[model samples]
Target: MRRGRIDYRMQRRAVLAEVRSGVRSVGDACDAHPDLVRAATHVGAPAREPCPLCGEDDLRLVTYVFDRKAPANRGGRAVPRESLARQHERYGDLTVYTVEVCTACHWHHLVESFQLVTRDTAVG
Candidate 1:
């Protein structure tokens, strides 16, 4: 099994830099698809900090999990953190994504991504 993780902080920082430097507009960055807008609006854990784009107190942290069997699994549905612990046992290969979103401004960023697999199944 492939065991690896990816962090998207650098990518997010690059995008933020573009926005701050006037190379990209926050509106452009926040102009997400309708489905994403709806999901970000209703799903995920509420964040305490205000939105970096619009200064709204409506940010949230969203998590999405995918397995080899279902790569395109569930369309941006909000999965509770507790559920992930259960998934680790069921799937041998899993990719987890954590995303931060500002519901009020429609701003969304991929916070991080990591792999999860059971010790019994992970290959050396």
Candidate 2:
């Protein structure tokens, strides 16, 4: 794939989602994708869905993706900043959303949103 051919959005979404869920350690996330932490910290989160970074509500969903393996076509993928687009082709179907919140504080700007379609994974 060409340099720009890779999908950075999906890559970052996968990484960020893992961090937000606590499934991936911050240190591990950083170690695995050094650029991810830096990019995430710098770029800020999206404005849709709940603010994953600060858990705020006033946000907007910008980028929405559909889970590739989703049985009903509704799946969410966590993505980080640095690993965007080029992370992997397997992430083709993962849905990623970029949101922006309306908080005066510059600290809280954007967040990522994900949805669980199935009951088993949604609640579990």
Candidate 3:
């Protein structure tokens, strides 16, 4: 259940626009962390679109999950997209974050986030 979802397309567009208009350098826009690139290579889902910054076909979508009901809500883990349903069943009121990454250029940005319903909160 993707409830309370927030889309970050506008922010992504703004960042891209800044890169294009010389406000932000390509290095600034494409500098994904090492761990993130590793996650994108291993667990990321192939995106439908190419890398917006580099025009490469290596864009991937990585998903991370955190328990909203837990204290501090820290230490989120990167999860494969295929296992989201099982993950949702295991955690109550979870927060899921999805990011777009380009394995080629190291570009990355948060694309969307939403709450996952546990068994208790699941609707029929």
Please give the ranking of all candidate structures by lDDT, highest first, separated by commas. Answer: 3, 1, 2
User: What's the true lDDT of residue 94 in model 2?
Assistant: 46
Best by TM-score: 3
Off by over 4 Å in 1: 1-3, 71-77, 90-92, 120-124
The 0-to-1 C-alpha lDDT of every candidate, in the order given, reads: 0.74, 0.43, 0.91
Each candidate structure's count of clashing pairs: 0, 29, 0
Worst 10 residues of 1 by lDDT: 68-77
Candidate of highest lDDT:
3
**What TM-score goes with each of the models?**
0.78, 0.26, 0.90
| Model 3 C-alpha RMSD to native | 2.7
Compose the digit string of candidate 2's lDDT tens values, residues 28-74.
53342333333344454544455444455633333334454657745
Positional deviation of 119 in candidate 2, in angstroms?
Answer: 32
TM-score of 3: 0.90
Residue 106 in model 1: lDDT: 84
Q: Candidate 3 on 1-124: residue-level lDDT in tens?
A: 5788899999999999999999999999999999999999999999999999889999999999998877784688899988888887787668899999999999999999988874446477
